[model samples]
Target: MPSSTSRRTVIKTGAVFLALGVTSCTGVPAPSPSSPSTSTPSAGDGPSAAFTFGTASQPLGLDPALSSDVESYRITRQILEGLVGVDQTTGKPTPLLATEWTESDEGRSYTFKLRSGVIFHDGTPFNADAVCANFNRWFAFPAALRQQAPGSSFKGVFKAHSDEASLSIFKSCTAVSADTVRIDLTQRFTAFLQALTLPAFAMASPAALAAGTADVLNQVRGGQPLSAFATNPVGTGPFSLGTWDDASVTLVSNKDYWGERGQIATINFLTYDHPQTRLQALLDGKIDGFDAVTVGNFDQLVKRGMQIVQRDPFSVMYVGINQEVPVLQDVKVRQAIEMAIDKDTLIRKFFIDNTAQASQFVPPKISGFNNEAPSLGHDPAKAKTYLEESGYNGEELKFYYPLNATRPYLPTPEKVYAEISRQLTAVGLNIKPVPVDWSDGYLQKVQSPGDHALHLLGWNGAYADADNFVGPLFGEKNGEFGYQDPQVFSKINRARSMPQGQERDEQYHTINVQIAASVPAVPIAFPISALALSDRVANYPASPVLNEVFTKVQLKP
Candidate 1:
């Protein structure tokens, strides 16, 4: 909405698909359902050295704090500046808006030294007060507004908002001075800084927030409601929003940007709902580069002399189980469902060659990946037996899968669902297909409260921590899973506060193992995703955590 191509299936470099904690950025209206995939470029006020990119889908929303889709982040990464950024080499959080920071109060507080001489796109000074304002804004979100954002970055990361103040980790944000900002947490969150690196924590212009009514969703674009500020986001990044239309989103280079400006004058993200359209666009020189290269397009692209860049495995495609379904409430039934799925067959047929079967959500590169995570291996006979023993009835389970969408984790939803449905049917379980268009609220419908017994979805790691994977998916009573286990919840909450060491790793390992046994969802594979590029680009900023920013991109002579 994304695939792997090469025999090795990955570039030596690694990158994660982070739109996580669902990092959606606020932006202009979304494209209409019937809108064309291409847009008109504004020549007069647009960038001189323009770069057009092909994308799989239109961004759901622009507010990183509210949405969690990849397309939204693709644009936001250029226009927004997070408090921190991820280092390409070490996979650790580095200074961005905050030049340096000190951890005190047993990891419960952080004092940041703001970078001087920085300003947002709206000419608002980027200072300590700005940082505190953003933090305070997140900490004090109203419950109704919190429910409005599908991604809910603060609710997912901090676990609470103003309504449940006592339960929240965010205690206060204080402007220690014009250049210093102090954030006090009610509890230790060892990954606080790492979490801050998310685009959702990016600082926006205070004046723009007020002028544009950032919190108000007064406009509807592409079926999703947003605000005026969302339409024209003002942040201190390498690019600023120039124009947004049905066919494309145009971003002009920020003339006042403080960092490396690179050579790009404009970036136009052209939406191509299908993989072939993207390939054709690049072939026709309609774009400089494109992402989400699929398996079907690999040989054709390679034969046509396209440069394919593969990102290392970081996302886990899974079949989400909603316990609210009467039949799914039985643990035996859930175990049977997992056992019926042949990971080997599924990956070999639908995924890139080397995609590894996953036992848990956390990737192997992360500290908490458990080699011994319990898995119900493929066995149709065994699965049938378990289902029969659990009082088998002809109950049709509604399985939801998105249409016209491609993602790093889920490259082809329909094909994947067909295979999975075939496997599940082999074990005598009644199956029902509920297909939803990607642009038509597919993600929200599945993730929100619903009667969907099962669904096709996955998480692309936002940060380098296990919490980024498990914490958001199983942190609490998520509408998607409806998995309520107090013990598991306590363990996950405790693990988030542990220092990054053996003890913390062990705790995460335990949590992964526990979740596997509980079977809230089935972790299928560590998918290898790739991007296709035009020869015009000498080098692209491919990051392991998807921290690619246009400022680092280099152009060919």
Candidate 2:
């Protein structure tokens, strides 16, 4: 997922501001003036049993391996199953397709016992061979394809760089028998099991793969305009793809699902980029609920009797500086950029009460979070001093921000960018604000190396492990920041290889502090993720790892 930095985007216009109560983006009211009716639920003629929610961004496609954004993951989770599932309440790996597993070869190999008597939606048996096939396909994804298409977000989890001292822990996956699969790792990686819990590693139907439809990721990378799998997807989960269009995507319950059938017959996600429009829709009862809810409208939504569910802060919203940029190459300049913004003020102006200012990339709950890292002071004088110390010439710093999608951490990106731009300007920096469409162009550009000078990005955790935070963005050279710190990389590798405990946590904490001092990105704030639901909705599913299982959700009347 765009870090919740890979998670998503959001926007602006004078008329939009006016509808949002004429308040600035940071202070704007979320709901439209027109109030929704407080009608009671009736047995008949009430809302459909189908649960309808809104997505702030449209998913790129339904192919899990090809998808890299939170929106795509949202849909993917409903349609697919990973070998391991996350326990929502405890944030630990739970059983899924693979009922149990054993670690051997000194933590270098894992043997999984597949769940028996399961079939894909297409009637093909799911077995050890299917698991191997999926692994083979992932391993075979051409390196060149990463450049052509939005590459697989799970690439790092599966493979390691050849040139670096880093060893590829994933050596091979083999089917030892019909009910068992053995995976050999080149080395021990403590986070390997946790990484398997990501949706990107979810087990897709091998029948779909054999039938040629599951090759959407590969085909799109070769320059196909669009992939068929995006609209028509086949999976063994509790829900199957129903209808997919530009406006909405629907999922119908899988009656023949291996596990308990979904209580709700249908799961519909309406694509609404604008927060006000989504809020109005909720108020009018046109939809049941929505995610990435605007905090500014929380009171109004509560007054309207909407049920609000919140997750502890798990994502980090930050200002990513491209180190390759000439102006940002100097450490002093990067530190100066970090000092320019007043994160406390921004958090107070935009986020919910629970949201806390961040000093490191990882949130407080993560094992490796550096609680003692010194927070950068909001000192324009010091910022100017650093700029002068760098002996820098005034250059137009291209500041990029996404325009039409919002994540839990970044509810109002345009407003956030405006404030950030204002802060930078006050520090005597030449900044050029560039707004790009969230899907049309923003994501690809920001994730590509050297395409940005400075960008506003956030990352929602896919798993609870510290590796989830440090490995993706800084393990090697990441596309977003283009940062390549050898010390940071070494520590990340060492931490991942060690078993989960205080020792491992200490290693990660050390790494985070070193990273904080390096200033790869300005750690901003960890915003609390929230969901708004209508009264009829019940047993709503959510996880700090961002997992939401639809099978358990129910609707009243």
Candidate 3:
């Protein structure tokens, strides 16, 4: 998985923000402080006790470097500390593990000064050496790490240099001094500092790593022995891993945490298989907080005195067309798929105002978004004409969607697939829905070109840059769904090479326009992030990157 930091950087470059000219009552409201009173008792009014939270899905994996799933990252954020952290007031990058850092004249090298007296969860010393080891391990397993979706950029950031005298490559990085360490990159990158804040780059203790007898600190691969320390992670963050059940997890206070201590001594993370079950848990007080609230139950939750935190997520949900498939290879056929489905109706009826009808591939929250680009409007007559002109004669089209991974903000993959099937049938195309498990289905069927003709997937802007929106989805090496567009590849390369300014923005605009014309993927909707919190948890900040820092979270008691 690409780090949240990288995602933000990509959005800034590729998916520039649009004005969102459409006026609707169902948009993101201004941020407000948590309500002080509700039917739920305040922490101070009751006993000072532990609080438990719940989610609709389980974490994909625990090892930070190997797993890129959102739920896993959320848990790791509590157990890990990065070199830099988001500012409490502004939510921008600030110094964390590294007190300060300075760049060289060419921006290729960085020297960091580690904070003093910081310790990992197991009481191991945290210093420059620990930082070096963590990064070295990640660089070693680049191929394995890159297998996770959106993690390909890790290779672009770090490079290893060999000593000619010994003629041997160095796997472990050396600390320059007690508090200082130097990192040499292959090329000058503008977002190097921001990338250091990613969970994949977080430092781990050498002691635990050695005791586990693992080559790397946190490795998650098939057939490899599980790291003993993963079940009880030790880091310099506010909370330490306590107990982990299949359906839930618990974290205890790290008494020696370098930052502000959490007001609550214990925090629990519970999981439910379905959205309805999660909402029921929240209403019955079985869980204190939950996210991605179902649209069907949004009204009931509000009536029950639950506080909903609504924000536009950086992700854009869409349908990916297999370019290798003969039927979809025709530009007119791709355009037919784009025009047949009704985005506005899907958003209004299925999502019920929780989603924005996406006009382009990128969402509006990203910076430098091109608002003037033309959107493919819903026109069934035109779609039918195009299908006839393109020589498509009711060919059977295979559409694959993950069965188990349905979120409330967006229409269920099955529902969207069914709608597409119905719409395309009107245009004289036979569509088949192939539903598979969320775990292996995405990688095996949708990502592989040999499996299906069409697949449903989503892209959450890794960085705020346009490069993020353009590069991964269109780059030649992007194996995800086997999409390889040479023109798109050239445009992304040009945009990346250009300096940060108007010139780069223009290059990205051209990329977006070209992508819209090619129609590799049909934009569906931009979903909103909906979260509910109990009155006891205070100062819970909202972030599009999903980097929830527990240091500032306070219990009312």
Candidate 4:
């Protein structure tokens, strides 16, 4: 929903100021995109001209359909091509595989005109039939496959699959003609086009899927679950997988690509879990660029003449509250937790300059932001009173926080946890710290049903839509929050089908207020994340949603 150019806003304190000019028409059909430079450079696609990027962790899986982590999406983005692309300046939907599209049937049906002559990396035709095949695959995913791939983006967007077809938004996929395809939905989703920009919806080669046994999760890489086809996905993108090992993941440019190849012939995403290690790697000439530049490294990068690009605040770091926990079921206890947090203090101490305290999950830049949403501001006296009113005895609540990991939203997890824990304890709440290493399945542990009562997690907005923020996180009852509010769920489901206008905006405003008042989770801060690069790079496409494709990187000669 947010797009930032050269415009900057001044922050009074340690944060870099930013001005947000959000576009409301996120689902408008964009004109046919000019394919990137189709001509190859004098040097062919090879590892000698590789540009290495430092990543905090290894990707969970190569298949975008199964993984939602930034690292995995980073790699898959180059290899996979979706029907829609994101407009860098507007954060709106643009044509990718499909040249143009039209919505009919009161937004319940969409027809796409397939781009002619496009072929998958496996030499299979990308036609109307191919489109249906991809759609059918996602719709018919077995119960076992769904269980193994818990982070299914399709389920998040479409609502369900064959297991619960009655509840699914998807109704049918039809090959209207050789170059035309149509999709029918049970309900109208206002952000349907915007949600298609997610990497998880990218197309994969049908031939390769059958040959590689895509359904079988029989392999493991870097302690991540994966299928054979996931290890060797085939897509009609600008790059193809080269090699993945203990050192790094390499990609070779697709010589047969239809668009601009730029100057980069090969790309490398190297693992450097720590911010200091990443900074050291860049200084040592081991890598060209890195993401998640923390407060500690920002000044150093500026002083050393490294290029640091700051992205607009497009993510929310929150204190997750699971309603399943008996103690947290009490509304007073939840209110106490929210009131106890001093968001201003956390932002000043741990976040970059210009980071704003968030009162709701939707970013302020988004259209649905409720200016009147009520916040239980920091009041230790009030929090103590709420706690006392709830119950006399204190029940220990396990707070989960990832260790040795740095995210765009949560820069320093350990430090942030310490401060938050202290504040909760100050309010007479019993808090137990559950520090888990990020690489040791911290996300799975906290996201799934477990002993964690409170967890430090956040949602990074993927496209320019309010549903992109609230639907996947709180649309329905899920393991992460274990929050099941039938009224809120019904309201959101109704809002999803409404056409864009004042009524839709008002509906979201009301929803945000409802979510905030109920206190399913405490919205803490909207972090302003940045990236650091070496002098060798002239330009890098730093996106707020992390929708960066390495082919856009331009190097200084």
- Candidate 2, residue 408: lDDT: 82
Q: Candidate 1: where are CA atoms >4 Å away?
A: 1-10, 15-48
Give the clash count for model 3. Answer: 29
State the TM-score for model 4.
0.93
Better of 3 and 4 by TM-score: 4
Q: How far is candidate 3 from the true structure (C-alpha RMSD, Å)?
A: 8.7
Cα RMSD to the true fold for all candidates: 7.3, 10.5, 8.7, 3.9
Q: How close is candidate 2 to the true structure, as a TM-score?
A: 0.88
Candidate 3 TM-score to native? 0.81
Clashing pairs in model 4, backbone N/Cα/C closer than 3 A:
1-464, 14-353, 15-353, 15-354, 16-353, 36-259, 36-260, 37-260
TM-score of each predicted structure versus truth: 0.92, 0.88, 0.81, 0.93
Compared with the true structure, the alpha-carbon lDDT of candidate 1 equals 0.82
**Residue 141 lDDT (model 1):** 79
State the lDDT of candidate 1 residue by residue for 419-486, as single tens digits: 99999999999999999998888888888888899999989877778888888999899889999999
Model 2 clash tally? 15
Residue 543 C-alpha lDDT in model 4: 82
Shift in Å, residue 203, candidate 2? 1.0
Clashes of 1: 23
| Residues 1-557 of candidate 4: C-alpha lDDT, one tens digit per residue | 11122113211211111123234343345585454433334444432467989998888788888888878898999999888887666665677888788888788898888778788888888888877888888888887887677767888788899889999999999999998889899988888887888898898988888887877889887666688888888999989999888768989888777666666778889998888999999999999989898888876775676777878888999999988898888989999999999999999888877789999988887778889999989999999999888963789999999987888999889999999999999999899999998767777777787789999999888876778888988899887888888888888888888877789889999999999999999999999888888889888887877888877887887
Clashes of 4: 8
lDDT of 3: 0.62
